[model samples]
Target: MSTKNKRGWIFLFALPCVILFCIVYAIPFIMVMATSFCNYTLTQSPTFLGLDNFKTIFADPDFRVSIINTLKWVVIQSTLHVLMGFIMALILRRKPKGWKFARVAYVIPNIIPTAATAVMYSLLLNPTFGVVKMLYEKLGIDTMQVVNLFGNSKYAFWTVTATWVFYSGFNMLIFLGEMGAISPEIYEAAQVDGATAGQADRYITIPMMKNAFGTCVILASVAMVSQFDIIYMTTRGGPGNSTLNLPMYLYKIITLENNYGKANAVGVIQIILGLVLVILIQRLFNQKKEIEEV
Candidate 1:
């Protein structure tokens, strides 16, 4: 085909995607922005309030607590998840005996529905008649006051975070795929140069897997920020809102309190936060890439 004709055909082909983007993403985003400014309960006609929702959400103590909790989750959960995933990926990279079976077992958690996992964990962590309680009792640890995982605020948050860390096998799979794609010749050369496995991993594998690491970081961060199903089904932001992440808090406002506008405001804040996080992660990755190239 002629160059001009090819360009015209490409533009025609891209038109559908552009239209779909508008329909799927742009339209709903605009509507959400609009809803954030209105006082609507979804039953009543929305009345323009002009930032009142945002103001209320900012002033609400519960919302503030939710934001703090979400920040904690984003920082702690994402870091732990990525770190554990990286470690698991590294360990699984080598073709050990039964490696395939181990990989399948690791990813089984990710395959299970979050709600089901949460329910299972809830039972396991239950203060009464739970395996955890029974184990602690068997170990001569007091089951009455010490074995309450969900009852205590400090333990509850950590318990929720722990559940996510081990379930990060999906992230491990991503990193493993990326690591596998690296040219085997590079590792061989490093070995020839008297590099140890640890040294090669430190200098070669990690640096080469920057893109995958960046993707994992972004995914984990977003998942932490928007997590609802497991946290809701497990803790329900219990122990007096101590575990109330942003999404669960927003759910309460919209559903329990019938505060749709305020909930939309929270959603807007979440989107803005997510955008900032993604931009920061991308910039960090770009800087690392430049440094590596140099």
Candidate 2:
């Protein structure tokens, strides 16, 4: 085909996707951004409020707490969650006995619905008839016997963290896929150079998986930023906003408070925050990759 004809066909094929994206994502984003600057609710049309919503959000103590909590979860998800997955991938790579079964078992939690996982954790940590209370009694740990993990301010944050942090199966699968693509010759050469298993992994395997790690970290962090279902299903951002994050706070503005203006303002902040994090992570990874290449 002539170049001009080929270009026409390419445009024709891509047009549908472009139109769909504008309808589904672009238009909604623009609407949300515009609505963020207005006072909007279900019963009334949006009134231009100029930055009042943003101002209110900044002055709200709950918003501050939510921002802090969201940032904390982001850090934990990016570092500890990704690390857990990486460690599991490394262990499975050795292909010890029952490795296949272990891999499948680890993935079960990830495959389950998030709401279901939250419910299971809620029951397990109910502080009354929960399995955790039973275990504590069996172990003679009286101090923890009366603790309501999802209710108390001091323990709710960590309790919510526990429900999701160790469920790193999705991140593990990403790392495992990256590991599988590595050439066997590299390890064989390392063996020939008298490198021990640890040395080979440290000097070769870990370094090679840097890109995958970066990708996983970004995914995990963004997921944490918008995490809501589990916290809502379990703690409901209480007892007294203890486990409140951005999405949970946003949910309150929309549902409980019936304020779309403030909700969209929070949404805009979330979008910007996520973008900033992604850019920073990309730059960090790129800089490291360049240094390694050099």
Candidate 3:
């Protein structure tokens, strides 16, 4: 086929997907951007406000708290969550006893719906009739004197943090897939050279998984920024907004306060924040070389 004909055929095949993407994603994004600068709500047409929504978001103390809380969750997700998955992958790399079963068990947390998880954790960590207090009491700690984990300001943030940070099953699956692609020859060579298992992993396995780690870091961090269901189910940004994050705060602006423009402004901020994090993570992981080559 002539190059021109091939190009035409390719465009014809791609047109449906292109149109669908524009309709589903691009159009909503454009609407959000347009409405964010105006005062809008369900009952009224958008009125041009020219940055007023953004200004209100910044001026609100609760929004500032949400930003700080969301940033904290992002850092923890990108680092600790990714690390947990990496560690699990390394553990399974050695093919320990029943590693396949262990992998399945680990993924149960991620597979459970966030609403169910919220409920489970709430019941498990309740001040009374909760395993946490029972365990604390058994350990000779006075649970009767302790506050409910999700109710107290001091512990609520950490409690909510715990819910997602350790559920690294998604990361584990990604890391495992990346690790599986590695050549066995490298491990074999290390073994022939009298390298211990730890040395082989440190020098070969970990170094080679850098790209996968970078990808997981971006996925986990962005998930944190957009997280809402679990928090809404558990704390509802209560106990003085201790567990509040960007998405939860955004939802409140629309549902409770009925500020559509402010919600869209928050959405714009989320998109920009996500883009910045993606770029920074890619640079940090040295994925730019791969991108450039592509």
Candidate 4:
């Protein structure tokens, strides 16, 4: 085929993806931004409100609390999630006994349905006859006062965090892939230099895995921003908005109050936060890459 014909074919093939992006993501985003300034509801038509929704969300006490809670989760997720996953990757990278099975087990949480996972955690953490409750009782802790973890103001947020925190299987899998890509010669060089296992892990493995760790950090952080399932299923932002995050808050504003404008405003803020985080993380990692190259 002629060069012109080849170019035409390339454009034809790319058109579908471009059209899909517009139809799905781009158009919806535009609608959300436009509607966020409106006063439309189930019973009324959209009338321009001019930032009223944004003002309302900012003023809302629950929204403020949700911001704090979400920020806390984001920090925890980005750090703890990536750490656990990186540690697991370091272990599995050696291809020790049962490494293949261990890899499969790691991602089991990711494959499970979120709602069901929440339910499972709830049952396990239930105050009465729950495995965790039973263990605490065995450990000689006072379980009677703080029986319902999800219902208690003090324990609700942390409990919800615990439910999802340790399952760094997805992050582990990502790190594992990155670890696999690393050249064996690098580790051999360290071995030749008489570097201990811990020293090698500290200097070589960890440093080389910076890109993967940064990617996990961004992924984990953004995932916390949209975290709704476990909170919704377990606490429903209850115990007085202790565990409320942006997404659940958005859900309540839309579903319970029919405040679509405020919901979309929350959504716009969420999208902005996610975009900013991704850029910041990429820049942070890129800077590290540059330093390493130097």
What's each prediction's clash count? Answer: 0, 0, 0, 0
lDDT of each: 0.86, 0.93, 0.91, 0.88
TM-score, prediction 4: 0.92
Ranking by lDDT: 2, 3, 4, 1
Which digits, one per residue and each the tens of the lDDT, describe model 4 over residues 1-294? 999999999999999999999999999999999989999788887889998989988999999988899989999999987899888888888889999999899889889988999999888878787887788778898877537888899889898999889999989988888888888898899999999989988998788887888889999989998888889999999888988899999999989999777788999999998888888888888945666689
lDDT winner, 1 or 4: 4
Model 2: lDDT of residue 257? 89
Ten residues in a row with the worst lDDT in model 2? 284-293
Model 3 Cα shift for residue 222 (angstroms)? 0.7
Off by over 4 Å in 4: 132-146, 287-294
* Candidate 3 lDDT score relative to the true structure: 0.91
TM-score, per-candidate, Cα-based: 0.89, 0.94, 0.93, 0.92
Models ranked on TM-score: 2, 3, 4, 1
Residue pairs with backbone overlap in model 3: none
Q: Evaluated with lDDT, which candidate comes out highest?
A: 2
Q: Give me the overall lDDT of model 2.
A: 0.93
Q: Residue by residue across 1-294, what tens digits does model 1's lDDT show?
A: 899999999999999999999999999999888988998886887889998888888888888888888888878756777888888899889868888898889889999998898889888888888888788888998777655677688788888877776678888999999998999999999999999999999999998888887888889888878899988888889888889878998898888879787788899999998888887988978945665788
User: Highest TM-score, which number?
Assistant: 2
Clashes of 2: 0
